[model samples]
Target: MTKTVLVTGGNRGIGLAIAKGLIANDRRVIIGARDLASGMEAAETIGAEAVELDVSDRQSIQRCAEYIGPVDILVNNAGVLYDRRVLQNPGDFDVSMATMVHGPFYLIQQFEDHMRKNNFGRIVNMSSEWGSFSEGLLGPNAYGIAKAALNAMTKALSAQLPNNVKINSACPGWVRTGMGGFTAPRSPEEGADTPIWLATLPDDGPTGGFFRDREPLGW
Candidate 1:
């Protein structure tokens, strides 16, 4: 059976690239974007379906889960970089956490049981090197902090999930996306490679780990 893969923020950037890569590999890809029109357009272009998903909102996430039903693979690629400094814009910090950390947490809780029952699941959380303590945990203030928390959650959740259900965090290095800026060294396709690899890991694949370019990275 073809697995249904949901890639959040799939309207553009690395998410869109990931969706395309999955589709090319014969997986059923669903583009989850906050904007229905753009999402639909991207889905149509990629020959996939689109679902409105605003990862910052719990109600939106719940509604999306209900609409899409069970997901075989999940790529938590939706994220945000707040405008102001952590102290300058505390609200933005909340926004950052809501999207990067809390949203993925809710999705995991909502679908983990289903995965457990099926005895198969693959989850890839889009993390950043900025989240790596060994690398200095440096980036936009709120973005770095929120992703560190996300990395922690990935490890915590993996411990409880079934052996067949693999969950791992991936850091797609700076890529040429709207978020990554034009000068980034990598392209979206290059960035998607690692996450796609994690999403399609074999039964013996590693779990509860952080990886970049398919290699383990410091947490």
Candidate 2:
């Protein structure tokens, strides 16, 4: 059976690559983007369905869930990055937090019922290496803090599910994308591997773990 997969912010970047990888694996892919036009174009290119979704908006997330019923896989790939350090401007912190933390939390809540009823699901949160408290990075403080919160959510949800579902976080290292910019070392294709792996995990796979390139990393 073809699994129903939903990837938020999948119109471009690592999300797009992971969506394409799922398509190649014969899964029914749904690409969620804030822009309908771009989302539709991307879905057309990848043979997936497109749904309008702005992760920062709870209503949009609900609408997307209603549009794509009973998703077997949820890839929370929508995140924002503000290049300001924590002390630089405290005002902009909410913007990063809303997208990276609150948005994915809402999405997971909206789909939890479906997952529980189906008795099988995978939840993959696209986190970042900077989110690791051990990483000790200083820049993009808001983004890192929000993602760290997301990682915490991953662990919480994993515990709650305990059976019939797996929840994990994937850190797609700095990849060359519109968000990652040209100076980044890795390509989108390389960055997508980890998320794709988490999204397609088997029943025995690890949950509540942070991973990169298919290997668990220190949190």
**TM-score per model over all chains:** 0.98, 0.95
- Candidate 1 per-residue C-alpha lDDT over 1-219 given as tens digits, one digit per residue, 9 for 90 to 100: 889899999999999999999999999999989999999999999899999999988899999999999999999999998657799889988889999999999988878888888889999999999989989999789999999999999999888898899999999999999898999999999999999999999999999999999999999
Q: What lDDT is obtained when candidate 2 is compared to the true structure?
A: 0.87
Q: Which segments of model 1 are wrong by more than 4 Å?
A: none
lDDT of 2 by residue, 175-201 (tens): 999989989999998999988888888
Best by TM-score: 1
lDDT: worst 10-residue window of model 1: 80-89
lDDT for model 1:
0.93
